[model samples]
Target: MPEGIEARLQEFDRKLRDGHFELLRQFLAKDYFGYSPGPGEPAASDRITDLVTDLKAALPDLTVAFDNIAVDAEGNATAEVTVQGTHKNELWGVPGSGDAVGWTGPVSIRAIGDRFAVRLDDLATPQRVGLVRQLRLVNPADEMDQPPHFPVVWPEFLLRLVFTGEVGDRPCSHLDQITVSDPPVSVCEQCVESDHIWPALRMCLVCGFVGCCDTSTNRHMAQHYQETGHCIFRSIRDDEGWIWCYEDDAFFDKAMLDRVG
Candidate 1:
């Protein structure tokens, strides 16, 4: 590993912590690719810029600390990063509670010459869920407010199922029709083309069509089911692996699927 890799990584971390996103561009390669980008963000650099901008806006006092940065001879680097800040503004539709919140997870960076050509932050899902919990956005007692839809307060529903063992209903026959389990694309193509935001994404199990969840304004997944008569879909959201059947109005978690299978 080049000695400059560690120095560049440290500088990247410092720039991010200082909210100097524009200066951080020197650490990224021209062909850099991040984990996933939103509707209008076409380039990986754009995705990183938007993410940090939103984070800074939501948590003005945000701080990021990177530790245990190790780089191999192949120029692949890994580090543990902890992000901490005060929730002072709205984030992902959750109103800020003015409370201190944080999450720690691993991150990967690949050195290309003197800049990083790839960056993958593994903390997004856990951080969002932890922030929601800290803001008291999820309430297990508010079952009435939770519709049969998959994305609404889904973490709370999962907690209830795990602790109470309240398996709602039997699996629908559509599970047999799940021929495609993986999503071909990360973003909803329709949403990207229309420049619309999708709260979450789903994949049609029958034909592997990727669409936005029902909570999105477009409800592209539901529309896909309606247009193609494909009823079974699975969540492709971060850290979510549950299945839903629109025709049967049924939901199945990984545990339930294993039990029934």
Candidate 2:
């Protein structure tokens, strides 16, 4: 192991564990790059700082523990880290459920001068999925009931369909419930009133109510479904005409209308 590398690693762990995020700059290179799933590009130092800040805000009592740390003579290091926290605020698109959530993953660190560049394990997808599950955004029982090959592709529409039973035998149970197809407004009214911006829009098929998609911070569409039992909604953004069923957890292309009719 390189001289002082282990001590530096320990200091880095202490800084993060103690929520002294500002001190992290002392351990990270000026051109530090961090890698994780989702964004295809490496995250710059500023983005990494923002992410950690957001994480701390969401989990007020967040804890990070490093174990099995191994350092090589060339200043390359690997360690297994476990993160634990209680969901006290909204994270990603899911609202806080006050659930204690934890995930363990491997991380790599390479010393560049006195600073280090960190990269999370590429197979952290399961950890993310598990985190969402812990937030109660996904139901394991419902997932078990889902078809083996869910979101099956329909060649005619070139879109995926997630439905139960044989496609030829019966259509989506919510398909016939659609009472409205056209949206009356272009903007998410809730977002506008709340002074928030939305990335996309969805209109309820049952009541023609327009709201923001899940990607939006407000997630007005999901709130509308929970409050009104309105199960289906269609995208009103761009030319993408896909419909989603909140009850069935399925997706359907607008072309499905022509096929069934």
Candidate 3:
């Protein structure tokens, strides 16, 4: 933890996850520099933002629990986080069937001066990504289609097949956490919408409520916990989705699971 930077970094993830772009822009520098191979088929800054936006929609209660944050004396910080949420909406282009999916990946951020200047990384699980590539088989966008801009041409079920694995054969219990903007008080969120917002966000074995990816902006997923005092959510949209808990104020990993029980 780096003094105020740790909390600040967490706040940034929340803002991005919450679809608070204005806040993100305010906290980040106008001319920031970032580098990574992510969402954009072409991988550009805007595409990265779009990808983040999409992820938010996919997992309304999406939370990026950070693993480590390193900030130097120069105010430059790089944090590694695992984005957890659900798949409840349209990803790529196909409509998500409110399935339980989760993605496991890392995010890299760069901070400078009084704000972050750049950030990049792929956030979805390799399985979901493969599904997207497979989808390209149908409605292939020219290689010129920028990442975050290209569209997947398969049904949402393919993602489940590639990511969720066989129902009982999951790597971990308390799988994917669904997220929504305005849950029905009963369900944390829904991902049936084109934007990945499931009506009811599922809970994992650890008792956290993560949301779908950026598709539906199921902000209510995190909001539900914040309102009800629950933490720990997984991306229900990625096959390898992980956990994010506010109590620990961090993301879940193998070590966490070891300690949780």
Candidate 4:
């Protein structure tokens, strides 16, 4: 929360607000990566002027709003932003919804000397499946007949680990130590890309079977649950993160409730 960084970010906001995109080049470094969420192609901007005209036309009301900004231990600046605008022109042939839609994703600013040299954006899902999951949380399955923007998998297998002899148990292990795996590649099957590895955390530090993360290409971990009807697996990474119930795409507190409910 240093005043200096905040001021810079605010200035970027104002420029975007006024559609003074031409000025963005001065602030961002060359070779900036800009991901057009949904069906459009991913683009890289070595200079902000690279896409200024196109962006302004597509997002007539385009405004950049900062949801959160963090400076990681690596000194990399990450900006989580929400882009909302009406589809004013032809974008990937979707025929302007003329409708305003919103999406969220992370962008990384690589700093060099006085300015950023590269801006990297790794995620932008126009499918917006997260919004559907939130909706289902409030309504029962029988009540809502609509499907999520993304696919949903119900678990095919069930496994449980307990601690302290209670439905609610004490922490047995941290996130980094947890691991999971099934037959063959196990959790690697569902991933979409090779850049990320599968089975983020193995089901068992004891077994060493690893699964892919949701962020990974195909969502192998979720598929592992659906195909095998398997219920639980230890996460691949360590942290305060919780075990997820694959069937519902939710975090589970008790093993029994972890089933596709």
**Stretch of 10 with least lDDT, candidate 3:** 164-173
lDDT of 4 by residue, 98-209 (tens): 6665656566655544455334254233223332223221123332322222232211110111111111222322333234333234444323345444324335232344
Backbone clashes counted, model 4? 39
- Model 2 lDDT per residue over 1-261, tens place: 576888888888888888787876677764433322122322334445655566678788887767888898887898987778998987554566788889777777777777776655544334534544565544453343222222212221112201211111113578888889789999988788978876568899999999987756788999999999998988885467677787775655576676666
Full-model lDDT for every candidate: 0.64, 0.65, 0.45, 0.43
Question: lDDT-based ranking, best first?
Answer: 2, 1, 3, 4
lDDT of 3 by residue, 54-78 (tens): 6568656656555566777655666
The candidate maximizing TM-score is: 1
Ordered list by TM-score, greatest first: 1, 2, 4, 3
TM-score of each: 0.51, 0.49, 0.38, 0.39
Per-prediction RMSD in angstroms?
13.8, 15.5, 17.4, 15.3
Error of 4 at 231 (Å): 31
lDDT of 3 at 200: 25
Candidate 1 lDDT trough over 10 residues, lowest sum: 160-169
Clashes of each: 0, 0, 68, 39
Q: How close is candidate 1 to the true structure, as a TM-score?
A: 0.51
- Candidate 4, residue 202: how far the Cα is off, in Å: 32
Kindly indicate the candidate among 1 and 3 with the higher TM-score.
Answer: 1
Q: Which regions in candidate 3 have their CA more than 4 angstroms from the true location?
A: 1-7, 14-22, 32-48, 120-261
